[model samples]
Each structure stands twice: as C-alpha cells, then as structure tokens.
Target: MTNLQKAVILITGASGGFGQELTRQLLEAGSRLILTDINEAVLRQRVAAIQNEVKTGEVLACLASDLADVQGCETLYHQVKALDIPIDILINNAGVGLFGRMDEIPRQRWEYLMQVNLMTPMRLSALFVPDMIEHQKGHIVNISSLAGWCAIAGMAHYSASKFGLRGFSEGLFNEVKDYNVKVTAVYPFFSRTPILQSERFGTLAKTYQGLPEHMITDPADVMRATIQGIVKNQLHVFPDPTANRLHLLQRYFPQLVYWINNRMGRSMKHG
Candidate 1:
C-alpha cells in the first residue's frame, strides 16, 4: 500500500473518544484534518492540543455542527467548499447509540440514532463523491460495530443503525470501486468510550456493572485500526481481536453465535 501522506481528511464527531484519538494519529501520520463536532468547546480544545503537538502537519479547521439534520449536512458541504480544502479521505465516524428494547426506546431517540448513524453518512458521501470522482481518487471509511452482524438484546435500535450502516458502506464500496475511490467499513467491539455511558442496554448494562476499565479496548486502538484500514484500502476492518472473532463466528456458525450471545445475555441479566 502506498502512503497517503498529508492526505486531507474530514472527520465528524471530532470531540468524542474515537474521534479525538483518530485526530491524534492522523496528525502523527502527516494528514491535514478538518475536524467538526456538535460540541464546539471540546472541538476547539482538541484542535488546540493537536496544533501544540505538531508544527508541520496541518489541522485545517474545526467547525461545530449537528449532523442529524439534513440541512446541517448541506451547510457542512458548503462550508468545506468555501474553505477550498481538498478532502482526500472522508471518515463518517459521527454516530449515536441507544440501549433499549425495541418498544422501550422513544421514537424520537430512535430516529435520532438512525439519523446520525445511518443517514448522515450517506448524505455526506453524496455531497463528497462528486468531488472525489472529479479528482479520480478518494477513500470513504464508515465506522460500524460488531452489533451490526450479531443481535444483542436491549440494543435493538443501536444494532439496527450499525446494520444499516454496514449495508450502506458495502453498497457504496461496490458503486465507487470503479471510480478509483476506496471504501472501508469498520466493526469494533465494546470500547471505553462515553457512548457506553450514553446507552442503557438492559443485559450489557449488567455485565458492565462490575467490569474492569482495562477490559474494554482503548479508543486509540480503534483509531489506529481505522487509519491502517484506510492506508491499506481494506474493504472490511475489524479493529479488535474479539470483534474479529465474533465476526468470523457469525460468518460460519451463525446458529452457534446466536446460542452464545443468548447465553451471555441470560448470564448478564441473572448476574
């Protein structure tokens, strides 16, 4: 794989756990990043830290915008064009999660998750694909999860969003492969991130109750795997060993996976 040195990359959710780590690695790898997140203050703080660390690699701009609204996505496109920064890699990493049974999660909350996790990526891809086409080179990386392939009780909505994202990423990959544009969808297992605190998964909640902090993978690992995938132009990336094993199990012994997941769910609930 050829090096994508100083590639202009746009990352959403720049203030969150994975986003922050990703920014750090991209800077270290000599990539010019345009960071954006809903939280303006955190975004500013992240950008400042990166600026202080690297005098040479570029930190293009940090803008604040909510990606749930389609109009906001349109505004983001306009803002990027106005800045005249060439976006060589687009990381659709902004997403939210809800941990509840299908009927337990509120309609608005479910919709919001869908908007952020599934819809926004497609909207941003649509906006950027033309430019990539014109330039005849680009890469799109969608951050998905292990939930996308396997079912987890109480996280129905969250799983649905990731499952949808996986499908979208796969379809987009095929569509753009002939255009000299590469697309990679990543699936990772549980990580020590703020998103875990944001969800209320009935079964997983119990398991997490007494879990050691070190048991979860670090956000930096996720960031590193994502970067490695983009650099290698891989189609599917499993960022963690556990996530990779689960994915493999799902591929060949789905019934066994179902049994194992169900047993785990029961154990968590009973614990």
Candidate 2:
C-alpha cells in the first residue's frame, strides 16, 4: 500500500470542490501538500484553512497558476522544481466543463477545456515522471469522469476531453509500470461539486434537470474512494456506485449502453 504519511503531493485545481475535499482528507492522512489553482486568493485561503485544521502535515506551497496553457504548466513546473521537493504523488484534478451542442459551443471555450483537462495533465506528468522513474516510486492520479466511458448529448466537448484523459492515463500507466510508478484514472459520475455550477449552454442545464437528485454523488464520498484507490494502486477507479455499475454495463453490454445513452440524448434534445 502507498503510504501517504510524509508524502509530498502536488495537486492541481486545489481550489475546486473535489480538489478541496481531497486536500482535506490527504492532509488528515498526514501527507505534505503543494496546492495549485488559478485563483491566488482562493488558493491561499484554502491553504490557511487546512493549516488551521490539520497540524500534522505541512502545506509546503500554495501556487496560483493557470493550467489551461502550456506556459502556465511550465511555470508551475519550474516553480515546484525551484522548491526542490520531490513529489511522491501528483494529482491532476484540474479540469473545465463545456456544455452545448458541438456546433453551438464556441471554439475557444471547448479548446480551453481540452487544454485544461487533457493537455495539462500530460504536460505535468512529463515534468514529474522522470524524477519518479529515477526514484522507482510514485503515483499519478487523473480525475476523469463518467462521460469518458458513456458519452451523452450536450456534453460532446466535455466528454471528448475526459475520454482523452482516460486514454492518456491508461497509456501512461502501462509505460511507467515497470518503474514502480502507479497511475490511477478516477471516473466519477455527476458530483455535487463546483463543476456542476459551471456555465451551461443550450439545453445542457435542462439535461441535468432530468437526472434524479440521488444520481449526483457527494464530493466527500468520491474523494474517500479516490484515496483508497490511490493507496491500493488501482489503475481505474469508479468512485460512485452508479459509475461502477455503468462501467460494468458498458463493458458487458456495449450496445445496450449506447442505446440507453442515445435515448437520453434524444430526451435532452426534445425537452
């Protein structure tokens, strides 16, 4: 099992709902943390709060850097490198969501989403993997979503980004397994997180309206399962029960899953 105590972890998107929850839990587990977010004030506030609550683990650094561009990624890497801390784990939890028909969504918005959700993780991994390989130990966690496994309407761009993340995580896991490095791709269904509060387009909000209240998972529960998955070195994690069941169905009954999603897509369009 991976020991989080004293482990130095770098978490992107540290100001978001899921990111904050993960930070809380990992800090409680006695892991040193480096938190990064685009919002400098918010990130500092979060670090201060965690410091107040948990006294065991150190909050090494709180960085405010955009992950939506290559330059931002490079800046963060250089900043962390300057600190001289060897990250034992890297959590690529930063992402953005775009909701609308493929044609209706602005090209720039979806492009930004892809950059933040897909390219940022790849870039960050490229920066840290070499050290992890040299040390022969580390873990990388990528927060993907259920949309990656089962695509639906009004989420064409969002789903594509998540799909790309999952694919990259899987490939990276295989590539680095021999070095004793673990990679986990977390696939959570809709969660009660700030991502849900992101601006919606067209009928996308209407589509979410159709989902049952119980369908939205809790951020804390998802983070708990995510931590467990990290400790056990699981390659793929379905943090919510619905996500796990959906993954099983997608595996055993691909056509059925496709048909169900197709029907849901039609409902979203008609309503």
Candidate 3:
C-alpha cells in the first residue's frame, strides 16, 4: 500500500546470478534481507560476501532448500517463521531455462523446470499472499522472461513456464491491487547469467548469438529498474530497452513478431 520502511524481504535462489545482485542492491537500499538457495555452501559464501563488503542491514538470513519440492517449500516457510520476521517483499526469481525441442526434452527434466519456474513461485505466493492481504501491504516480484511474450524454438518448456508466470503476475495484480498489494512481473531479455551455460536435455546450446557485451544485461541495471518499479508500484518492469520494444511490437503487430522470430531462428540454426 505504501513505501516500505525497514522492509523485511525474502528472496529465493539467493546464490543465483540475478539473486546475488538483487541481494546487494536491496542491502544498498536498506532492506532487511532473508535469502535462500538450494546450494547451501554457495549461499553462505554469498551472504558473507555481502555482509563483509556492503553496509550491513537488518537480519541477513540464508537457508538451504530445494524450492522445486513442495516439502522443501514447507521447510523453508517454517524456518523463516521461526525467525519471527514479517515479510514485506517476496521475490520469486529462482528459475531455469531449458533448450530442447518439446519431444527432445525428457519428461523428468521438463517437470523439474516447470516446478522450479512456475510451481515454486505459485506455491510461495499462495503461502504469503494471505499475510500480505491481512497487512494490506506487500510486493510480489516475479522474474519472468521475454520468452513469455515471444516464442523461440528449442525453448518450449522455458517459454511455457514464463508465460504461466506472466499470466499469474497479471491476474494477481488485478486481484490484489484493490487490497493495496503490489505485483510486478519482470520480463528481462537474455543476460550473462550462468543459466545460459547450464546443460539442458543432455548438452549445452547457445540459443542466441551476440557478443557478451550485447547479449547480456547488466545485473545492476536490472536490479535498479526492478526496485524502482516496486517503489513506484509499477505493474510490469521490462529490464532491457530492447525487451520493452519487443513487447510493444508483439502487442501491436504479432505477425511482425513471427516474421522476426522466423528470421532469428534461421540465423541461430545457420550459425
């Protein structure tokens, strides 16, 4: 409903590429952070890095749990509750991108991708939304992708999950705006995050072609734009200028989008 003062924010995938940047920026902005990741050692190391190098904020808690699992979500919720901290912001940014044709991807891998990208966010939002409604204030930031709006070959599962996340964010925005709970869906273009290097469906693939300079977004810029959006209560945050334009183009001229996508697909295939 209003700007958060000394907000207690919980971020999932704290050790992730964007997660680390988000934590640093939030600390700079003076938020009491609660961070979690499936990788415990990496999580602890990152927490230490932030606390040692950055201005210390309120309780900086880190925990380990596989958010892709339902029980893991329950365990994480309980652990945070035990801390007895009120949550003012929930960032569901832990996600994976898989590159493979629909039939080429294993069912198990697709399920895991869906759970991490879609189900975990949905579950956590369900857990925390009631509290936000009771307090009549909170922020939900879902880190979706540009793939949500435009289709790309070999990214069927990834695109589906983001599409679901985007739809969820929009519906939640309309559902909770009257209650003063703000929801922001972020659609970021390709970033230089480790996700791009991850092995998908058995092998690694360079799904896009561009210099690292041009292909990846600066994490700091994404964080700045996202926090600004939250403070301004913006419904959508397009972290890249190119991504924003693509979204506009898709909305007004979908046929043009398909034409461009076809050309890009050819380039990727030929390259």
Candidate 4:
C-alpha cells in the first residue's frame, strides 16, 4: 500500500471542483503538495482558505499556468523543478468539456479542448516521468472520464480527448512500472463539477443534466475513490458504480453499445 503521509505530490487543475476536493483530501491525508491551475487568483484564494485547516500536509506552492500549450506545460515543469521537490505523485486532473454534433463544434474550440485535455497530460507526464523513474517510487494519476471507456454521442470531441488520455495512461503504466513507479487512470462518470458547466456549442446540444440524477456523482466521492486507488496501487480505477456497469456492458455487449450510441447520435440530429 502506498502511504500518502508526507508524500510530495503535484496536482494540475487544482482550482476546479474535482481538483479542489482532491486537494483537500490529500492535505488531510498528510501529503505535501504543489498545486497549479490556469487561474492564479482563484488558486491563491483556494490555498489561503485551506491554510487554517491544514494540520500535517503542506502546500508547497500554488503556481498557476495555462496548460493548453506545450510551452505552458514545459514552463510549469521548470517552475516545479526549481522548487527543488522530488514529486512523488503527479495528478493530471485538469480537463475541459465539449458538447455538440461532430461537425457543429467550432474547429478552434474543439482543438483548444483537445490541447487542454489530451496534449497537456501527455506533455506533463513526459516532463515528470523521468524523475519518477529515477526515484523508483512515484505515482502518476490521470483523471480520465468514463466517456473514455464507453464512447457516447453528442460528445465526440470530448470522448476522443478522454480516449487519448486513457490510452496514454495504459501504455505509460507499463513503461514505468519496471522502475517501481505506479500509474493510475481514474474514470468517473458525470460528476457534479465545473466541467458540467462547460461551454456548449450547438443550440440543441444535450447536457449532462439530461441524465438521471442518480447518474450524476459528487466530485468528493469520485476523488475519494481515486485516492484509495492510489493507496492500493490500482492501474485502472472506476470511481463511480455506473462506470463499472457501463464498462461491462460495453465489453460483453459491444453491438448493443454501438446500437445505443447510434440511436443517441440519430436523436441528437433530430432533437
């Protein structure tokens, strides 16, 4: 079991709903952390508010950076490196959401989403994995969505980004494990996070609210499961119950899943 007590960790997207919850839990678990987000003001405010509750775990720094560009990722890497901390855990938790017809979403908007959701994670992992390998003791956690496992309609671009993240995490896990490093890909379905408030493209785009209330999860629940998975050294973690059920259906009833997706896609065009 991986002990989080005093573990040096870095979390991207540390100001978002899921990231905030994860940050609090990690701090409570006695893990030292370096937090980063795209918004500097919000991140600093978040850190300031949490300082009173901090008991054992330390917040190393709240370095904010835009993770959409390769240069931004490299800059964040260099900033963290300058802090002189050997990060034990790197959580690629930052992501954006998009909802629209495959062709309706603007090219640049979807492209920006891809860079933030997929490219940033790939870049950050590449920057940090070498240090983890050298240490022979570390964990890299990718916060992928269930959409990555079971692709659906009205979210082709979002699904594609998540699919890429899941794929990268899968390969990276194997590549670094020989060095005694750990990697975990976390899949949570429809959590009640700011991503749910993500910008929509088409006027008739389906929203996460369309799903049944039971299908939406709390960010805290999802992040709690993610932390537990890390402690257990799990490779692939489905934090929500719905994620597992859907994964099984997708695996054992592939045609049925495809047909459902087709119907949904058809309805999006008509509805």
- Model 1 Cα displacement at 38 (Å)? 0.6
Residue 236, candidate 2: C-alpha displacement in angstroms:
0.4
**The candidate that achieves the highest lDDT relative to the unseen native structure:** 2
Clashing pairs in 2: none
Better of 2 and 3 by TM-score: 2
lDDT of 2 at 39: 94
lDDT of 4 by residue, 140-222 (tens): 99999889977776688999999999999999988998998899999898888888767776754643235545658989888
Candidate 1: misplaced stretches above 4 Å? Answer: 54-56, 201-215
Tell me the whole-model lDDT of each prediction, alpha carbons only: 0.85, 0.89, 0.83, 0.87
lDDT of 2 by residue, 102-201 (tens): 8877788889999999999999999999999999999999999999898887788889989999999999999999999999999999898878767676
Candidate no. 3 TM-score: 0.93
Best by TM-score: 2
Candidate 3 off by > 4 Å: 1-5, 202-213
Q: What local lDDT score does residue 196 receive in model 1, on the 0 to 100 scale?
A: 75
Model 2 global lDDT (CA atoms, 0 to 1): 0.89
Per residue, candidate 1 scores C-alpha lDDT tens digits across 1-271 of: 5255788999999888898888888888888888999988889987788678866668888888889989989989988898997789999999887776787667888899999999999999999999998898899989999889997777788898899989999999999989999999999888888887776644355444422445479889877987888889998999989889999999999998999887766654654
